[model samples]
Target: MVNIGSLVGAGGPNRGQASYATSKVAIASITTVMAMELADHDIRCNVIHPGAIDTPILAAFADESEDESSERTIDGVGLQIDT
Candidate 1:
């Protein structure tokens, strides 16, 4: 199983979520084993986690300007389009 989730890199530079990171890590490990075990049953288990979308919470951090805030939020807007 491949998880795109990231508790480590998602909580910004200030917040250090150790518990959240540990949980995600445990979840990832469980997912990996489950996927391997369930593969014989024709079950394709996978997970997708999209980080830092253009949401209101993210907007608060980016209060300078839409263009300015969007740079850090969505990998820089001019270089990429935020989905």
Candidate 2:
């Protein structure tokens, strides 16, 4: 089982994103449990945290300045645009 998680799981909470952060934490915990329990069956469970990808949802939550800063930060990290 592959789960999509967030860096927020380790970074903790952000303003107005309590639920989002909590869900990511839960995903990690669930993935861990699934991995342990399914190991006997040779099934693998894992979660991936893709940090700070540019998306419409990101802009919806951030103010103009924050959005610009995020863009710069993501660019600085050399994130590739697949499309």
Candidate 3:
């Protein structure tokens, strides 16, 4: 099983996103429990925590144009993951 979470879940609470972060945290926790419970059945469970990407969701929280916001967000941070 695959679950989608966010960097927010791991980073803890943000200024105005308590609910969103909590939901992501739930997904991660569920994934972990599922992994352990399903291991005996040979089922693998995983959760992905992706950083802020260029999307309309990001635009919703931006103070500038969507394109500019996305560019700034993507260019300003370096989030690397090893797969």
Top candidate, metric lDDT: 2
lDDT (10s digit) by residue, model 2, range 1-83: 89999887755655556898899999989999999999999999999987876677555433343555555644554654443
TM-score of 3: 0.70
TM-score of each: 0.50, 0.68, 0.70
lDDT of 3 by residue, 1-83 (tens): 88989877765655557799889999989999999999999999999887776566555555343466444544445622221
Give lDDT: candidate 2, residue 69. 53
Best-to-worst ranking by TM-score: 3, 2, 1
Worst 10 residues of 2 by lDDT: 58-67
Per-residue error for 2 in candidate 3, Å, reads: 0.6
Superposed by TM-score, candidate 2 places the C-alpha of residue 74 at a distance from the truth, in angstroms, of 7.6
* Of 1 and 3, the candidate ranking higher by TM-score: 3
Q: Please estimate how well model 3 matches the true structure, expressed as its whole-model Cα lDDT.
A: 0.71
The candidate, 2 or 3, that scores higher on lDDT is: 2
